[model samples]
Target: MSSDALWYFARGSGVVSLILLTVVVALGIGARSGRPAFGLPRFAVNLVHRNAALLSVVFLGAHVTTLLFDEYANLRAVDLVVPFIGNYSPFWQGLGTVALDLLLAIVVTSLLRHRIGVRAWRTVHWAGYLSWPIALAHGLGAGSDADTWWLWTISLACLAVVVAAVVWRTSAAFEARTDRAVRRVEPRLRAGIR
Candidate 1:
């Protein structure tokens, strides 16, 4: 209803967007692990990941829209498309724009995945790994409450969750590969080919 409310909304939505992005990334890693997450099936994990990603986009839209409307930030339309051009916190704001660009690319490619082929879709999707960190950096650097302890706590939690997921995924992949290799080699050894 007022500028103050708009500012608060922007900040709140930005935080929520970051949280949602973290969930999406974690769920993606879980999906790759070939194991169920939270006792849920792989398909369920995938569904949650897709839904969380969409929700992040929604909150991001709110964050950007409110920032543009809030006169204090002095955000320009160009700032949304082109990174680093904004006079207000240029570097930090630019990182947010870059993150947004990467996210949009991933979303667009995902939507057109059937047409783009699996390789192209997967290559673009990998940007999710990069997007989350850029977003976290933007929040820490550009956010007005960056210095707050609560924000730090939340950021750390997000970081921990993602790190754990990645570690789990990597180990699972290695084990699967090792199992396949063992299977192949064992058959050859039994046949006296090794």
Candidate 2:
């Protein structure tokens, strides 16, 4: 297609990827929250998370490919792997590169989770949290239409959803930890072990 069409396709893919990434993050947090929904089971939540993550990856591939093909962006293939190595809006594009690298690591470790061990997999998975924000920043800073109201609305909504999920996760973790501490202290007090 023409350069203009290719550019539009790239921008569209990037926006869709961001939306999918938000879904993946929300599903992951929801699953971890451990609250049973009306009909959706934990397994289903996990399955959706995994599938959405894969879908996001696919869109990301499209975004990268279209950008590379669009002469206007001037993004070299190597820029996809190596951060800050691209001539295209170097710093912002580099953030995208870093986000992509983190995502790849998350995906590979997830696929190999059984063999690599749960602890290792979890450690890598935390990088997903980092990747999401880096990607948002890249999109906001690098895109030509960042000033558009629609993009800003979507970005803010995504941010709100993720932030809410994080707050839920953190409170749940803290509560659980406090419960365990209380349990430990109660047993010691009863046993006179002070």
Candidate 3:
């Protein structure tokens, strides 16, 4: 395939990943907001959120690796991690570097959560929110196929996940109803226990 075609194809992948990343962030927000204080049964929510974040990371890995191989991009694996390591676009490279910093912050915080303290770790972990926008900007700025229909579709889908998550968390009725459901279940019966 031609480099242009491959570049667009990679951007297509980027679009899908953007949605996945958005979902991870949204779920992370929900999982964070519904702490023990809300008495909203956060165990499952947190679990899903954590898994979502991991999946997002996986998607990001795929996106970066694929981009590196796109002949149109003079990107190395180090460029993905080191930000401005790309010789092609110095300004966009800087943006990538910032995004890389955020990704690293999130990964390091998650891995060291115990030592960092929950509050501090969570605060740092919230940087996942910044990763999407930075990535979106990089895709648009550096991607050769930013205008492709698939790319737009993916971007919109990612936007939808963020919107849905915000709506769900802010819904008073949903929270109250879910809380009642949890109460009905009984504590010992919570985790598939008899």
Candidate 4:
């Protein structure tokens, strides 16, 4: 395939990846809301997010796979993980490498959550926020399709959702902290803890 085609292809796949990441973020917030989130809404949100994440990863795999097929892009599968090696575009190629690394970390952390424990899983999963931006940058910088109006529109939508999710997570964390402070002061709460 032509270099232009490969660039457009990666851009499209990158958008799907971003959308999946957003779903995962939404699920993560629900999971943090304590036991109160055991209801259907929380369950659905978590389910969709998890499924989306998996799908995103799948599309990412396809995106990388296609890069190899597109001879003009001159990318190998390893370059998907290695960065700076995709002969299609070297200077900006490393961004994909960084994003892929972050994604790998998240997947490993998630798979090991049961064995490593929830706290460890949480610490690693927090990397998702940073991964979002890195992925976006990779798409925009290395993408052959970056200049398309449709691509720009989709990119903006992804950015909006990411920002909203971050805001919600921050708000939830603050509320949780506030609640903990109040609970810490109440004699009943202290007794329950003990």
Q: Report the lDDT tens digits of candidate 1 across residue range 1-194.
A: 79999999999999999999999999887777565665678789998999999999999999999999999889999999899999899999999999999999998999999999999999999999899999999999999999999999999999999998888667866578658868978989999996
Whole-model Cα lDDT of every candidate shown, in order:
0.92, 0.89, 0.71, 0.73
Q: In candidate 2, which residue pairs clash?
A: none
User: What TM-score against the true fold does each predicted structure earn?
Assistant: 0.87, 0.84, 0.71, 0.75
lDDT of 4 by residue, 1-194 (tens): 67778766765676787777766765666566542332446567677768888898888877777777776677776786777866767757788778878888889989988999999888888887678778787777777777988777877888787676557656866578658757666877667754
Candidate that would win on TM-score: 1
Q: Which prediction has the highest lDDT against the true structure?
A: 1
Model 2 residue 63 CA deviation (Å) reads: 0.4
What's model 2's overall lDDT?
0.89
User: Which 10-residue window of candidate 1 scores lowest in summed lDDT?
Assistant: 30-39
* Superior candidate under TM-score, 1 versus 3: 1
Off by over 4 Å in 1: 172-194
Model 2 over residues 1-194: C-alpha lDDT tens digits? Answer: 99999999999999999999998887787677564322467788888888999999999999999999899999998999999978978999999999999999998998999999999999999899889999999999899779999999999999998887777667766468557768978988999997
State the TM-score for model 3.
0.71
Q: Per-residue alpha-carbon lDDT of model 3 for 1-194, expressed as tens digits?
A: 67777676666666666666776777676665455423436787677666766776676666666677778677776776666657778667657667767987888887999998999987887777888778767766766566778666766777777777678777997689668867877775967776
Best-to-worst order by lDDT is 1, 2, 4, 3
TM-score of 1: 0.87
Candidate 3 clashes: the total is 1
Model 3: pairs clashing at backbone N, Cα or C within 3 Å: 83-97
Candidate 2 ranges beyond 4 A from true positions? 34-39, 170-194
Query: Candidate 3 — which residues are off by over 4 angstroms?
Result: 1-13, 35-41, 81-85, 171-194
